[model samples]
Target: MKATATMVLFPELQSENDTIASQLLLLPQNITKNPCENDRTCNKDSVNINVVWLDSTSHSHFYRSMPKTVQILRDIKESGSLNVFSYNLMQSLKGGTYVNTVAFTSGKIFSRSYLQSKKRGIGNLFNLFQNGGYHVSMIDDLCWTWSAANCACGIPTFMGVKTQSWISEVVLGKRVTIPELWGNFSKELKLRGLNDIGASLANCEIMKANGITDPFFTGKSKVAICYNGLYQTDYLMSSLELLQSQLNRANRPHFSYLDINLGHESTGRRIQTLDVSLAKFMSFLGRQNNTLTFMFGDHGNKYGTFVQKSKESKIEMAHPVLFVLASNDVATKLGRDWMRALDINQNRLVNILDLRQTVLSLAPNVDVESFPINAKYDNHPNGLFHPISRKRSCDSMGIAPEAGKCICYQGRVLQRVSNQTGVVVLANFALGELNNKIQEQFLAANGNESSGFGNCRYLIGSWITNVQQTVSQNITITEMDIHIPAGTGAPQSEDVFSVTIQVGSNIPALSTNIKLVHHERISTYAVYDDCRDVGVDGDLCVCSATPTLQSWHIDPPTIFGYISTVINLTRYLYIYERRTPHGLNLETSCDSADKTFEVVMRITSKVNVGYSKKYPLTFKVKHGTIFFIDVFYQLNPKLNWDVKYDVDFKQL
Candidate 1:
């Protein structure tokens, strides 16, 4: 139930009024309060901290993909309304949204002790803001439903403050149709009459065709992270408008957390649509003389075709976008020294921990310029508001050697090692971890019954596919892919896993030096009839029942048609020609000697029913391994070659 200004409780909506009252009594007595009205004079001591968080956006991707957004941001920066700090702003941890957000909210790295304590609100920004006498609100258009701060998705809750307001798509507990949602949004637009920042309905018909009209229409409680839709952005736009109304009516200092999931949730697809809406939002903030706005990304796109394309993609994921826009009043109050520090620290090595400190420092009358000497996070003692050491590296910032690919570390001088023993050791370690995960999943599925993984057999590494290593400051980073053979009776397919590990200089010391940093199953698992949920990640499971393995040879025309259908290039007709069963394309990047077959194809554009010219294409397949076949074409001389089609052999 929504809490009102008078703290009235609706009997049907909630039963926790007494609990909320008791919690309010625990608040400190010295909560800051300025009797001055919400005007320019009130900004002398404090300003509302309005944070707009965009998930999974990297600085590089934001600049490259969202041209209009970048232009607006550039204009704001030139106008001295925004600060863009793109470089050296790394993620506090290597994990996904949850980990980075934890650091952002709590100002601490995630640990077992923190989880064990179960103190969700203590020492967090929510409590800090409340202590500063700010009316706190967390708003999200997708994936969050706040009921006493508990996330509906079973992740640990945020805030845990009962008085804080939650505005989310799932808050009402009843799913509405896309049209119904749009009607409500239209009514809200009429009420506010801020039509300049209207919804972006670009590609609306296409999105509808792809079943992406409603934010909550996925049949799940929350929208999936990888899902894409224009309505998601529209929902956020409407929600932000509603938040503006709330802020206007709020008398106390406000701390608003606007969790915008448009760009990142869709895996960096259709982010251009957010440019106009965000530009307007920034403009609105620019006019708010007493507001300090933070518009930043949690991290870059972690899982997508974009991230897997090149090494630069990985670097982009490490460097998230951070823009701190201080209103004119707040900027003047920060003084020249603080402004100078903000400028210098833009290029300094910073992360979510530092951002946490920065937010904490902004609390009313808090002067924690430096962290305690013995504090666990003492390495990076100050926030962006203070001067940061130029000599500080990832190590100095207490970033784990395996935490992430740090921009400060120049030791990623990769050298390919042939048949290294360390590769085998790390591969085996990763395989063991995968098997252990499978066992754990099985145990959990069966209500913690330790009767073993009933029908699932342990995966054994059949052969190593690829290995590459880099040594940076006595730390060795090894990336290897090993093909794990499916259990007997399962489909005749190999499950190739790409694993990354970090170790000390003593690579042979498998016990203490080795640490598995990242691992994922690259190949697809075709059969899981008996143990569907018992696999490491729902795909590595191999049922005990033996299925008939059928091998069929397709005609040339049939192969071409299959390729054409899967690629979805309606304007092209393909023709496949087999070179040889043992043919290997030595000129291509397919260096594996175990390649089973190679084929050449000629693709022709069909302007109408007639075929245009034929373009020769070649691809080599390593039988049952994970590989990407990229098809490129240049539509015009001035334009760069576009990757027209990509085929993942595992999916085939």
Candidate 2:
């Protein structure tokens, strides 16, 4: 028998108020006859569904033109219906468009690449259903792939669907096979496979095969029959109508899940046709007097420019839309404490685990009293039914500051507040004692080379750059661009910096491969300013040296914007001041004739942000700005040095 879930679909576009008011008339009102009074097919608490996630709809994408959806909101406001609240969802840093390292993992010291590979052990979120004898089914959609088929591995597969490894079975500790009996699933059962079949007719067949009370549905199929219908308008609309007709017949609690794609592609807009159709479905379900519903948005704007604008903007994208609706009996059966908490938290910080716990509480067979008080992934141990503290910190919730978003009032965002860390900027010479430390690290890395420390000496040079600062107690983090400078005021976009080394007819862009990462040993309290070409008469030209400067203390830099990973050291070479005959011939242009008597190699690396003992240093920073320095070195194998490049930089 085809499955007819108690949960119904009300998928709509993002909020578009005007469109909602006009387009709602287009929604179908299928429940014209009242079965409640005559057929005895419905009652006051037949279904206890706590979730109804409409494919890709989030608050940011909620369309105003959907009449049915808008009407439901209006009805809730007018009737003071079962308790509903606003929830905040966390975001992966850098939004859904760019695949960065901070998307899934949440520790401080981590690379997103290596961390994602270790999340394969999936767990059972449906053990309660197995004990309660309730059937769980899913329509073909993207969510089955992300939330189930792949078991939250962050969709790393090429098809953006199942990892084809039976991951759900592994996690749930039970079978989660598809309805297809044998062989590979036909392309017909996948997304866009609807062809011309009505969703209702298809579901009726499943109902015949699997009786309402059948244990494990015989084959333990996961009801993953309908594939990727979210992309098609008619298919989704038809599916909604068909599902509603059956739900109107539903007399027991069951689970149905589906996902829809709006084709936003991160453009920050929604389809008008979808809004009305979903609203209609939602409106129909809103009229039901025997059901409970939970509605929410997944991670927002998986692809878009709005995702990277600012921290607040990132939070906006991560923040999802959430709502809960129940009939009078269902609401009352939920008990007194849950009702009180729901009434108090109209707008509160929420995580998905809380919702999962609530679903478990509704199951009849599962021992709710034995349910674990805390979940590994929850913001708190208790579910939404319990009163979660309004003052929970993101850190305790295991949310990485970079990948987390929480609710806050004006002047309340903790990132804007200072951490009470003090940093004092000092002259380049202030760290002269560090020269020994630098030599130790350089020798350790290259000492094994044929001509290593004997020819290559450590260059202890530094330059001061600009840091975005606000006089107000709060610090507004700004973007750290990837521009590098060869000399003072001469910023270049080229990341692969190289100085040509004239070797026969070959003029390769060979500059010593030197990468600067943040050094934990170097304190942010002291920073050296970049040197400039100041004429020391015709006999000698002097580069601008460090002056006694006041150090400005600031707060930690958030990754959304501030990240000064690379600094300019071109001026430290003192080549900008030396005439044709005075210093090493250095050309800023890549096309210039090759003439390098010293170091030559290419350097490539990303800017380092967090500083801890776990990772190696690639650059040094002060007051939240990375320093750049240039020091000349000889390419000769001989240990004797003709030009003390390290000393020259030290003198500057």
Best by TM-score: 1
- Candidate 1 overall lDDT versus native: 0.49
Tens digit of per-residue lDDT, candidate 2, span 1-652 = 2222222343435555532311111233233233244545433333546345543345555633345575666666467654444454322222221122122111122332233344322233333443343334334322222222112222222112233344344335556555431112223122211111223223322323333211111122222222223323445455654554554554434444443434223344443445655666566555665566776655454323343233343344456556776666667777788877765555555655556566656666555567554433443333667876666444345433233343342233332322111110111111221223333333354432311112112222222221122111222221111112122121221111101111111222233322121111111100111231111111011111332111111121221122222222332211211111111211111111221122232222212111111112122211211122322223332333233222111210
Instruction: Give all candidates' CA lDDT scores.
Output: 0.49, 0.34
Give model 1's TM-score versus the native structure.
Answer: 0.60
Candidate 2 TM-score versus the reference: 0.48
lDDT for each residue of candidate 1 in 410-524, tens digit (9 for 90 to 100) = 4357677654343554554555556556656665666532333456655555666556676766677776666666554443455555677776544432223545676644433
Worst 10-residue lDDT window, candidate 1: 21-30
Clash counts per candidate, in order, are 0, 51
TM-score of each: 0.60, 0.48
Model 2 ranges off by over 4 Å: 1-46, 54-58, 63-68, 80-84, 88-122, 140-234, 247-250, 308-312, 368-382, 402-405, 409-652
Candidate 1 regions with alpha-carbon error over 4 angstroms: 1-35, 38-43, 81-85, 111-123, 143-156, 159-230, 245-251, 263-267, 365-381, 411-425, 444-468, 480-498, 505-512, 517-652
